[model samples]
Target chain A: MDKPALAAWLGAEITGMALLSGGAIQQNWALDVLAGGQAQRWVLRTDAAATLAVSRSRAEEFHLLRAAHAAGVTVPEPLRLCTDRSVIGAPFFIMRRVDGLAAAHRVVRSETLAGGRQALVAALGRELARIHSIVPPRADLPFLGEPASDPCRRFVAAMRVLLDAGRLPRPMLEWGLRQLEISAPPPAATVLCHNDFRTGNYMATEAGISGILDWEFAAWGDPHEDIGWLCARCWRFGGPGEVGGVGPRAPFVAAYEAASGRRVDPARVAWWEIAAAIRWAVVAIDQAERHISGAEPSLELALTGHIVPELELDVMRAVMARAA
Target chain B: MSWDGHEAPDTRALLEIARTTLMEAVIPALTGDARFKALMVANAMAIARREDGPAAAAVHAAVRELGDVAALCAAIRAGAHDPGSADHDRIAASLRALAEARCRISAPKALG
Candidate 1:
C-alpha cells in the first residue's frame, strides 16, 4: 500500500519510509510508525522487480518466520501478512526491524564483533539447531511438504531440473550432480534444514548473532545439510577460516552437536559441502541466465553469470579433494 | 574533412579511467546510499575493463580445444575421463588451466 494508506490501515501516522538494501528477491523498507503518541520502527518487505523462481512468496515467508519465532529461533517478529495485492500492488509483510549486520562480506571481516569468532560461530550453530528443532505436521506450518526418501537424490534431481529448464546443458554441474547421485548417502534423520544457512543469511552484532534471516529455502532434509552448507568454502567470502569464514569446522560441529544432541559424521559433512558448491554453481548460472535471456537486464546479473566458472572450479577442486 | 591527430581512448582505457574517477574522486565525496551505488558502479566498471582486456580472450582460447564448458563437462560426466583413467589427468589439467584463466580475469588475487 501507499505510505498514507498503510498508515491509515495501521492506525498510525507515517513518520518515515526508507528503502533498505540487500534483498535480491524482496524489497525491504524501514517504516517509522507513530501510533498513540508512541514511535515504532518496522520493516515492510515486498516483492522485487523480478523474483527468483525458487523464492517463497511473502505470505509463505511470513508463516515460516512466525513458526521459527515460536520455536525459539532468532528471527524478526512477523507482525502481519497482507496478501491482497490491491492493498500494496503486491503481497507484503511487516516485521520489527532488528539491529545487526547481515551483509556476508562485512560480517566475516568486521573486527567490531566482540567475544571473537568462537562465540559468534557457536551462537550460529546453536541457532541453526533450534531452527531444526521445528519438525513437520504442525498446524501452523502445513505448507512444509513431506520429507524426501533420499534427500540428496532429490536435491541433485532438482539441480538437474533447473539445468534442463535453462536449456543450456552445463557439464561440470552435471558431472558434480552425477557424482553426488552415485555417492548419495542413505537417508539420515530428517529435520527442518535451512537450505541456505550460510554466512550471508544471518544478522550479527558485536555481541553476537541477533537473528537468522531468509527462510525461503527451508526444507525437510538431513540436519547435517545445514551444517555442511554453513561451512562451505564458497560462503567463506575469501576468508582464511572455514565455519562460515569465522573458525574451524571442529568447534562449529561440536557446538551444533551440543545443542541438538546429534552426532555429526565428518565424512557426511564433507559430502554435503561438495553438494553446496554444486548447488551454488547452478544458482549462479541461473542468476546469470536471468540477464542473458532478457528476463532482467542487470550488470550485477551479467557479472554474476561470469562467476559460474569460479563455482565450477570449486566443484571440480572439491570432487578431486574428496577422491584424493 | 580534416581528421584530428589525437587518438581516442579505447574501451578498456575509458573504463579504467571511469573506475578510477569513481573510486578516487567521486567515491570519497559520496556517502551512504550514493557511496554504495558509486562503489557498485566502480566495481562494474573495473569488471568491464578486465572483461574488455585480452585476458578474457585468453580464457576462451585456453578452453577452445574443449569445444565448450558444457561439452567438456558432459565428457567428464559420461565417464570418458573417470578419476583413475589417463584421460582423467588430461581433462583435469585442462580444467585447471581453464580455471586459472578465469580467475586471472575475475579475481586475480584469488589465483595467488
Candidate 2:
C-alpha cells in the first residue's frame, strides 16, 4: 500500500516505513506516523503470501492482541484493525511498536542476557500464567475454536491425520504419537493456550520480556500444552537451559505456580514435550510441502523441513527418557 | 585433479566449493537477514554435497535393509514396534541411525 493512501486512511502523516523481517507467515511493517500532531511509531501486520492452515486472520489477531493487553499480558497495544482489503490489498492491523529483540539466535546466544535470563524466564512464566487465565466460553473471542475435550488425544489424532494425508511417511513421528496416545494423561483444566509459545515467539529486552507476539495459533487447550511447547527441545535454539533456552525450568514453573496458584505436573509436562516435538515436525513437513508443491517457494521453508530429523530424534530421546 | 571419463570438478566438489565460498566470502560481507539467508544457503549446499557423496549410499543401504520408511511407519503405527517389546529396541535403533544420517547431512553440529 502507498504511504499517501495509508496516511489518508489513518488521518496521519507517514514519516517513515520499513518492512521488518523474521516473520515467516506474516508481514510486519514499522511505520513512523505524525498523528494528532505528534510523532509515533506503529507496526502494521498483514498476511504473507501464504500462511499456515491454523493461523488467525488479521482481525482475529487484533482482537487477540487487545484481549491479551487487557489481561495484563505484555503485548503490543493494538490500535486499529482494517478489515477492508481495499486499503492495503489485504486486511491488516496497526499496533504500537515496542522496541526489543525477537531473534531466536540472538536471544539464545547473546552474552549480555546472562543476568536477565532468570528474570526473563520468571517474567515469561508469569505472563504465560496471565495468558492462561483468560478462560473461554465468552462472546468476545468467538474466533477461538472450541476447547479440545481431550488435548492429548486430539493432538494424537491431528498428527495421524497430518501424517496420513502427506505422501511422506514419518516412522519416528508415528511411533512417538503412538506412545503419546498410549500414555496420554487425563486432560487438565482448559484455558486460553498460546499454542505456539516458544523461544522465538516473544520479544525480550535486557530488562525483561517486552511483549509476547504471534497469536496466530492461539487455542483453548490444556495449560500444560503451552508450558511443554515453551520448554520443548526443538524450540530451544541450541541454548543450554530448558526454560525457553534461557534459564532452568524450576524458577519458571515456580513463578507460574505462584502466579496461577496451581501446581504443575513435571511428568505431564514431559509427555507434552514429546508431543510438541512431533507437532513441530508435522508443521515443518507442511512448510516444506508448501515449498515443494510450488505454493510458496521459500528456501527457509525447505530448510525448515530438514529439521524434522532432529525433531524426530528429540521425540525418541524424550520417549526413552520417560521409559527410563 | 585428473579426469578419466568424467569432469574433474564433480557436483559434490562444486557444492563444497559453493558452500565454502558463501560461508567465508558472502556471509562475512552481509549483515542481518541476508547473512542469515547466506548461512542457510551454505548449510543447504553442504547438505547437498554430503548427499551427493557417500551419505546417499549409506541411507540407501539402510533403507534396503529396513524396507521403505512408509512400510516401517505403517508397521510401527500398527503396533509392531510397541515400546518395550522385543522388536522395539531394533526399530528404535534403526530410526536413530536414520535420524543421525540425516542430521549428518543437514546439521552435523547438532550431532555433538
Scored by TM-score, the top model is: 2
lDDT of 2 by residue, A138-218 (tens): 678998868888989999998999999997778778879988988999988989988888888888777778889999998
RMSD of each: 2.9, 1.9
Q: List the residue pairs that clash in candidate 1.
A: A1-A88
Compare the candidates by DockQ and give the number of the best one: 2
Which ranges of candidate 2 are over 4 A from the true structure?
A111-115, B1-4
Compared with the true structure, what per-residue lDDT tens digits does model 1 show for residues A217-255? 887889879888988888898765688987767677778
lDDT (Cα, tens digit) per residue for candidate 2, span B1-111 = 555887658887788787788888788999978887888888778777887767677666656656777878887777888876888887777777777777777767768
- The TM-scores, chain A only, for the candidates as listed are 0.96, 0.97
Q: Residue A239 error for model 2, in Å?
A: 1.3
Give the per-residue lDDT digits (tens) of candidate 1, residues B13-92.
78888788778888899898788777767766776677887888888887785676776666666667776777776766
Candidate 1 matches the true fold with a TM-score of 0.91
Query: Per-prediction DockQ scores?
Result: 0.40, 0.68
Q: Quote the lDDT for A212 in model 1.
A: 87
Name the lDDT of candidate 2. Answer: 0.85
For each candidate, give its TM-score against the true structure. Answer: 0.91, 0.95
